[model samples]
Target: MATVRVQQADFDIGAEVAAVTAGRTDIGGTGCFIGTVRETADGRPITAMTLEHYPGMTERAMAAIAEQAEARWSLLGCTLIHRVGRLTPGANIVLVLAAAPHRQAALEATAFLIDWLKTRAPFWKKEHFADGAEAWVAARVEDDAAAARWGGGTAGRDRRTMAPGGSG
Candidate 1:
């Protein structure tokens, strides 16, 4: 099974992992990723990072991504939680966990889920520098490549890109 959530509060890694694998003995390996806000970028101070997302649409997209990952790999369980709103310098941004029968499947699926989530999900990030200036973060080429490895970007399949009364 796969679970997805978007919340403002921080998450507990150990609890999240335990919850996902509670009764699952089939999984022999588990993979996890925790993304945290960095305080410095090459000695420059970072004040804050604000994340923007569409409430209903973002959740649906994330659920779909989780489903895709579950189907693409031999996954026993998966959990994805991404925090929104204003976050301080060292807050946890997101967490991706995957459980599988083998380490390879667990690790790769975890990476794939996060990489695709970054590009496909409708989440935007803004960075505040120490000088008090803030700027919307530009999408990274590395993020593009990460999503591309799984096949393609979210363009045509994006819910927001769909017609007003139609699914994308």
Candidate 2:
């Protein structure tokens, strides 16, 4: 079973990992990725960031992404948790865990999940600057390039061209 969550509360990484691999003797290695809110953007001081997503739609999209990852890798278990609402610098934003019988599979799955999540998830972000200005975050070319490596880019079947409400 895969673990997926979209909540505003913080998560315990150690506990999550333990839960996923509790009785998994076949799991030889576990790869984890923790995303955090950054303090700056484009050399500008950032105060906070707010993440918004369509409740039901967001979860379903993530599930599809997870399924794709499982199809590509020999994964024993997978976990993806993303925090919503306002977050300050250094706060935990997302956690991705992948378990497999080998380190390579685990590592690759973890990387693929994150890259796809960044590009395919239906999440919108607004960054608050220290100068009392805010702006909606735009998709970056680097992120698209990252997801493209895993065949989940804009051209893929699992691609998320526009966010919820049909906005880009």
**What's the lDDT for residue 159 in model 1?**
31
When summed lDDT is taken over every stretch of 10 residues in candidate 1, the lowest stretch is 153-162
Candidate 2 lDDT by residue in tens digits, 59-137: 9878888888777896889999999999999999999999998999999999999998988788989999999999999
Highest lDDT among the candidates is held by which one? Answer: 2
In order, the Cα lDDT scores of the candidates are 0.86, 0.89
Candidate 2: residue pairs that collide: none
Kindly report which residue stretches of model 1 are placed more than 4 angstroms away from their true locations once superposed. Answer: 41-43, 152-168
RMSD of each: 4.5, 3.2
User: Candidate 2, residue 53: CA error in Å?
Assistant: 0.5
| lDDT digits (tens) for residues 1-168 of candidate 1 | 688999999999999999988887888999999999998754778899899999999898899888888888868999999999999987999999999999999999999988888887889998888999888887776877777888855552433435667543
